[model samples]
Target: MAIVSTSTSAFYERARAGMKDLRSQAETLQAQLGSGQKLTRSSDDPVAAARLRTLSRLESLSTIDKTNANRANADLTLADSAMSNMSNSIIRAQELATQAASTTLTHSQRAGIAEELAQIHDDLYALANSRDSSGHALFGGNNTGNAYTLDAGGNAQYIGSNTSAELPIGDGQSVTRSMTGRQLFNFTDANGNDTDVMATIKTLAAALTSGTADPAAAANDALGSLKTGLDTLSTAQTVVGTRLAWLDVVSERRTSLSELRSTEEADLGGTDIASTVAQLQQTLTVLEASQASFTKLSGLSLFDNLR
Candidate 1:
């Protein structure tokens, strides 16, 4: 009798442990169904979890790349617009210089034209010193000061850094966000002499108002310089266009890569609702059977059987 009682008690304990285990499994399946994500714990699926971590990191880096691309694009766009305006201003200067070159124009008439030229010079100076969204000089490379400033002699000079600003758009990709003042405005004339558009216009204005005996000669030289400046400006614009095109290509590639990472992450981390629900059903059925068996065992006692 003693041996039978001990055996029954051990059986009851074992049955209770099995019921608890089934309940725990049912709860886990239910939680997985609610969360819609399998392998909540690393132990559930280590390989998938590791892959998911890598994908998540890739997704984060992709977002940063996109932000850099947008900033670079915007800065380049601003530079392009400013270049167009500068080109138009240079063209107007050419027109004014052509008029001043006529021998028939009197000193007074040329002086009037010089005033307009002076205004154009100021406009070009301001345009060259344009700022970016962050209030830094857009054409000043990494320098925060104005790109073009007036010297004691009233000549426009480039005081900015020589290098253009660059932005990182990807893991190993970068692009120039802006052109330095020297790259866009300071160019060489046919005589191989370095010339800046603002200074060229200023010199023309001085010639018109100088009352030199050969004012027409100075006007002719001014016209040639203007032509050289135009050609140089066109070349710079082309460079900016090329960079913009490169940015577009980079943006497209980054977007495609981001989408691929997202797909991979979903495959690794996302749960299968149908399978989880089926598993929940099986767990609940086992748990119910275990509970019923446990209750029956609890009702049976050695004393009752002995009676």
Candidate 2:
């Protein structure tokens, strides 16, 4: 009722070995595909997978921070340029006012100077409406698309909305990216005096061109007002410089923080390829040997007949 065969025993043993090899090969292939790295995956080591995910998250956070920093830098740059142009306009007006103050200039001469001053006022309006690289007005306050428009009476008046958009640069830091004409150039001075440069230019132009012989006394009065307008422009320029300095400090800190985040990400998620490759090779060798042994043992089993 019983039969003894070395071939049968070897056949059973070989079948078991082949099954184990098949399972191992499947695992190795799965690991290779999953890791794509041939070694670093959850199946290979769960701890490494968790750490890699953490690193990835850190990297993403760093990218967001970098974006915030870039916006801050861009906004500050735009403000700086706007202030510089306004400063130049102020200086030009100062020169004209000084010339007008001189007694040697006759009525005709003062009228000519007033004509030029009108052009400068228009130019200043254009500068105040200047836009940034993003198509938003640099001086329009809060990233408005349009700048100040002249009223029916040729006064500089703003058409943009009232909201001031604040940009965030992380850690509760914020900055307003724009300023309106009303806030800067057309504001009331410490003495509650109106110093709208456009208004001053219009008034001066009308008076000088009226053919009044000895407009010298009136021109002298305008010099003080011109100085007031100059002060307003200067103050705006100073604010721009201060904002730029703050942005510079923040930008420097952001760069350093980004570097630290990069290092943390590397430590958390980076792979070690050398050890992974060695294990893959060993699994392949074992699989090949089992396949070869199974092929030879198939002939010796009773379940098989060679024709």
Candidate 3:
């Protein structure tokens, strides 16, 4: 065989470089174990890192969607409760109207019933102007002000938008956040004339208190319109209930999607502890062996070998 020679310094340099590489590998594996992440930088796994970025962005958007859904849920729930109260008030008004329609009641007694009806009108107006969880008008649609405004004649007029605001709930879906006061309080009467609950009640109260030729006739006339108004209110309540149920479904879907994203995120970046620890242990063993060999070799000289 031909003689091959390497200088002591060159041999030492080669050994040190090999040891340095082994130590770097060991440190990398140790870091993976400590941090519980497979990637130290985007360059480590560009494809996975890009996917992770997309997932993170989606998570942020989903958070916003959840918040919006919660707000819509709260607003709709408030509207439902307020409408229930309104229904109760309408039922009470119907009872009073029945009492006023009786010819046996004295004029003073009919006047007392009219006073109660007027109070019910005021109560209904307050309910129509009920505030949402955010302190905004519940039945005002997107308007920040009261849903109904009082005119010079003391009549309640709808001042809100025709339709409520829609909120995004994720996956390209949206829901109307609330119903407008006009939708609940206003309806077509039996005579084909457009009328509102507040106006009808106000007129009936006035007729009763004014000592008209026939107070019972006025009360009888209002009964048909009040019944129609109550039907309208009940229908609106059903709509609100349906929307609330839809929100619940959307929320559950969002939660499932979020869980799926989390699972994908963990799969993409999370470190395998058992595999990383095994690699670290193997690297340390090799490094220790190399170090011991270098120490023994460096201490020996040609003269000492001969001796």
Sorted on lDDT, best first, the list reads 3, 1, 2
Model 3's TM-score against the true structure: 0.93
How would the candidate models be sorted by TM-score, starting from the highest? 3, 1, 2
Clashing pairs in 2: 141-178, 141-179
Cα distance off (Å), candidate 3, residue 188:
0.2
List the global CA lDDT of all models. 0.88, 0.69, 0.92
Per-residue lDDT of candidate 3, residues 1-307 (tens digit): 1232457668889999999999999998888888888889999999999999999999999999999999999999999999999999999989999999999989899889989999999999999999988888899988998999999999998999888989998889999988999899899998899998889999999999998999899899999999999999999999999999999999889999999999998899988888888889999999999999999988977788687
Whichever of 1 and 3 has more lDDT, that candidate is 3
TM-score of 2: 0.73
Off by over 4 Å in 1: 296-307
**What's the TM for model 1?**
0.90
Cα TM-score per model: 0.90, 0.73, 0.93
Error of 3 at 78 (Å): 1.2
Q: How many Å off is the CA of 13 in candidate 3?
A: 2.9
State the lDDT of candidate 2 residue by residue for 143-250, as single tens digits. 457668888888777776554466776667876655566656675644578667767766666667886665666566666776777777777667767776887787
Top candidate on lDDT is 3
